[model samples]
Target: MAKNTVIGFLGSTLDASKRDSSRWQKWRPTIGLCMQQDLRVDRLILLHGEKHESLARFITQDIASVSPETSVEPHRINFDDAWDFEEVYTELLDFAQGFPFDPEHEDYLVHITTGTHVAQICLFLLTEARFIPGKLLQTQPRRGQPDPSGSWNAIDLDLSRYDSIAQRFAASSRESTSFLKGGIETRNAAFNTIIDEIEQVATRSSAPLLLMGPTGAGKSLLARRIYELKAEKHQLSGPFVEVNCATLKGDNAMSALFGHRKGAFTGAVADRAGLLRSADGGMLFLDEIGELGLDEQAMILRAIEEKRFLPMGSDKEASSKFQLIAGTNLNLIDAVASGAFRDDLFARLNLWTFHLPGLADRKEDIEPNIDYELERYAAAEDTRVTFNKEARERYLAFATGPNAIWSGNFRDLSASITRMATLSPDGRIDRKTVDMEVARLQRLWTSDRGDDDDTQLSAILGAERLTRIDPFDRAQLSEVVKVCRHSASLSAAGRDLFAVSRQSRSSTNDADRLRKYLMKFGLSFDEVRAR
Candidate 1:
């Protein structure tokens, strides 16, 4: 490699001082560059404007006189406005690209001090983007300091130390959270806090993390995201292994989780390496962990605590150093009370437990998630699909409405988008498509609703009040109950549920009317809200 050259725009007018013979006494930056013995500017490309052509010649002569070894070349450029960022940028870019460049024998530097702020920024961009392969040189004024020739420093275009880059990193973190949630920026603060903590723990620690949530509430998805995050950080080296404990039963459970030797079971023909062995040096996600039998749970507890387990029909114990992330909808405490789950195993896995909320609890995030689902559908199908303004509004209204149970959480949202995207003609979803999808979702949710909810509701409101209201009224009021449970107050629930009715009422006592309606069923707003 050869020496680096300084390529700068000439501040011809600024550097032309008639009062000084020494030239160094004037403290002009281009003159100051000649004073630095450490930086060898073998060649200097002086870019000048049309008006400064004569001044450019004088400065070039002055530079040559001061430093006989340094070669200076003056080039004139016509600019409509030096102050205009676009004009300055375009002109400088053209000049930088058209220059006779030799990277193997020479390096370069862009003098940022000689031009207007616009020109300075343009030079910085070109250098930073590698359009001009060099660093930036900034010259500072002496301002009555001892050094008359003013100081000079070189600035690398690396922005890693800047606050703006940190802000971008934070934005990427927010994006990662959205990715884990299937593109939903969940508005639930508790859920967001959990995500933050999980991110920290996933990156910093390998302790077992237990995710507890209702089925379809994204436990499995979150577990997978934790694996991905850890993998990205190079915290885990092996592939992620996932298994649903609910599907394992009897001898099959032991064989699937702990491996089995040949002739260990009726159909065993070869030695098997189970999920635990497969997850060595990585993560094992056990979904529905409460369904594991007692015998399997004991062996799993040993594997988690000791990183060692015995293969079935073999006396030798195999060791697999792996991390555990268990997910379950079951309340393990209740399971312990019923002797269904091992107490010691639950304790080991309970060190870090996160409860994920159902879709209904994060209604505010539905709109953004709708757009995300559309984008996801487009990517998967390799076809663009967009919902019209009115159609989007209609779908959002129904989705966030009390009638939308969202029993399947993100799974349901994805399915809904898939259906609408498929049915949409020409990749555009209209009002008709929205209505059909809404009706289909309603039917699916209605069919999915079992008597368990009605039984719970009956227990909460008492059978006496339930019998007084007809089943039709009961169904209508159940929706009202859901709204009230989610609302901040009775007034808010009334405002949402009775928006049209409140408009018609001469006396705007929406909360009072809502109170009276609940009172007829022997229920109070506070009781329903608490539920």
Candidate 2:
């Protein structure tokens, strides 16, 4: 491998008048670099202006006297004004780009010690960005003693090995993930990983995020949380404006999202700043974006790409600089194929798409979410509710069981908790409350099945047996069958079912009694078990 080359601008310290017999009195940075025994500076590219030509020549000779092996090459660059950051940065960038670099054979070092602060910062940025594949070299002046030769150090700008920095990043990642989760301790590893990546993206990116999932799967909730995280991080300043695109109708959709001039439509009585404008410098969450009309889709495309759009009935364009987070339950790719959604808009938002899992898919998270829901209810109702140990377990068993059909995902869970908390006597949900809740959930799941043969009822009693059951007794029997399906055996189900009723009986034959009852419904252990 070839030795590294040092590049830096010549300072006034290289001038003959600034030179001294005692090197410690005024040790210039450039001289310090050449005198370093361990540094292998094969070639030095000294940048100089018209007035610094003499100084550059003197430095070259001085460097030769100190370190003869290092080759010095002076390059003159004109600057309209060195103090102007824009001019200096542009000139330096152009120079670095034009320079012939043999990356495989040579390494590069940018000496940041011998330039104006602006120039130093530009060089650091260039090196850090890898525009110039180099490390930054800094020279620290010695304060005391016989050695003012000073100390030289190189920085690569990558601090991956620093434990504090790594820990900080890990902590921030956890915090961001928690923010997106609404502080719920989500147990789904895949969902947590996705949230972690989203947090990282929210922290560093302004690109459009497309959250695709079924309704009630927390897409809207996660989008709002992302906006809040960005705001808290100081990445965004304006309000988080949200709009359900599915609710937007007719010409109002355009006016609501892209603003409208007065008289744009019959109902457009006044000029309006749309959701996009209101979200300026912040985040705009357009939920159910797949519901937008084609014209609105095209307008959204323009707004996302150009950050400008023409308002309805307006001749001029309006600008709104906002980060966008779009949500939808519809498959945009399918919609695009069907000519219902714009292909271009889908492509743009597809850059960072995350699919939130439904409640059924994340059963492990139900326990924590149950607590979260209860806490939310307490906050809203100003009454804390606690579930008895067995009540909580009973609820979780049914919730995470195969019989549960959470069509409404989190919405259903939240509603369930709200109802239980509202009705809990003395703020305590007992076994009776849990039983009622379970029965209600079963009814809901059964109703949601909508005459399907593969429903929880059919799965327990078999489709043929369900057809013979009376409509009046179907709801009551369905709950019984659900318990039977969850039990380890028919005897276990009978004992639990007749725990109170058996006390009225002179003799207890719970299993035999339950078998005879199931026989009345034309169902048997063999048939229900097969189902």
Candidate 3:
């Protein structure tokens, strides 16, 4: 087969004075560079802001004047007119679909102007929709004064890194739902831990595995990462199939998983291989497993247990040895108790359950995650952007502060970082940007925390106060708690908490403080030790 490539260009518009013209000049050259590197530039879709039609015409004319060989088409959709995310994404997806690329032969190049939130979201959705391969190019203004001649300013970008960026975005988006705020830090541990476990299970587990976690804890990422890891580790020879249980309600769930023959149902026009069959000898990830109907759950249970399932209207049983990874946020034990989920099925799944800790639980990871996000955004913008030290400190403080209970976890973080990165000038994020985000988060937290009564509020406040005390006192209390919990003797507790090998004057004072503090809190030394 001949090596053919398709290039896609998506940007707001060149006419917008707010956009750096020097940055805009980089597009054609970047495309030209890619072409020189053996990448064929086929379709260019120009996404515009307000005054889309005129801007599109101007850009098209500009490209024609510069390079008569290149054909650029304007996808005339005004982002300003977009009332909702769905509308913007849909328009972008439709335009992207129009790119004339033979998927069988050509690789795609997707270029965006400065990682805008709309652009980022559209890119993520496009990947999820599977319209085009996940790829992106970021163009930035080149340093130095413009040439005295009418030549366009220079811009630098790396074309080859698109695929890698897309993969990272896909992985992050998959794990977005699992974290309070989606970003490199929040998803890192969850992604790494899940990938490790999935690999182990794929190679070692005989029975089907169940992934249990709260909503947005990244079950889907885990599932996909598992598939990739397993494919590499076990040399699996089949495709990874994913089915969202929430989308496949009623009898459609059965047909989607276990394909039906022609005339099996109202829409069954032809025979099709079910996801299970397609995933044979590979992996099938069932997302939102709790949403499946009882009958569907029964069918899934049988398939998992017997490795065989009959399609609707077909008596013949189809055999599939696909590894099952079912994901759900529901309390499966409660579901079983309530008879919503089968006890036997729950038992089978419980054996391999892995709970993902929410973002609030991993406070230490927030700063590192933010740093990672800034770097990603900077790279995508083709700029050397860094967070102001004050902004970084403020963000870390907010993340670890009482206000951070990001229910959406990593997804929220991803959105926030993307916004900050796009809006910041030359990628210099400031405290105001951080303040806006913090205020938004605080409002959300306030609304949620309002559900709790005074008693709960007081208890939480007390805990927060304790956490803010001096490091020495905190360390002493922690040591006392640890010794009390593990050591069998009082001498051990005194020695460990006070760092004294034997009881002494200084040790007694330390013990007294510990005792007094415990009493102040209406607890005995034993209770304080118990922690």
Q: How far does residue 491 in candidate 1 sit from its true spot (Å)? A: 36
Residue 70 shift from truth in candidate 1, angstroms:
48
- List TM-score per model, in order: 0.56, 0.81, 0.48
Candidate 1 lDDT, 135-202, residue by residue in tens:
88888777776554577888877766678887897887777666666566667787888888787677
Q: List the candidate 3 regions with Cα displacement exceeding 4 Å.
A: 1-199, 378-384, 444-531
Give the per-residue lDDT of model 3 (tens digit) for 346-464: 87777787776666666766677677666777678776667799988877776777556677776667667887777787668898887776656554554555733322322333433
Question: Whole-model Cα lDDT per candidate?
Answer: 0.83, 0.84, 0.62
Better of 1 and 3 by TM-score: 1
Cα TM-score of candidate 1: 0.56
lDDT, candidate 2, 220-247, per-residue tens = 8888888888888898999989899999
Q: Stretches of candidate 2 above 4 Å error? A: 1-4, 13-16, 19-24, 36-43, 84-87, 94-108, 144-148, 452-531
Question: How far in Å is the alpha carbon of 462 misplaced in model 3?
Answer: 23
**Number of the top-ranking candidate, with TM-score as the measure:** 2
**How well does candidate 2 match the true structure in TM-score terms?**
0.81
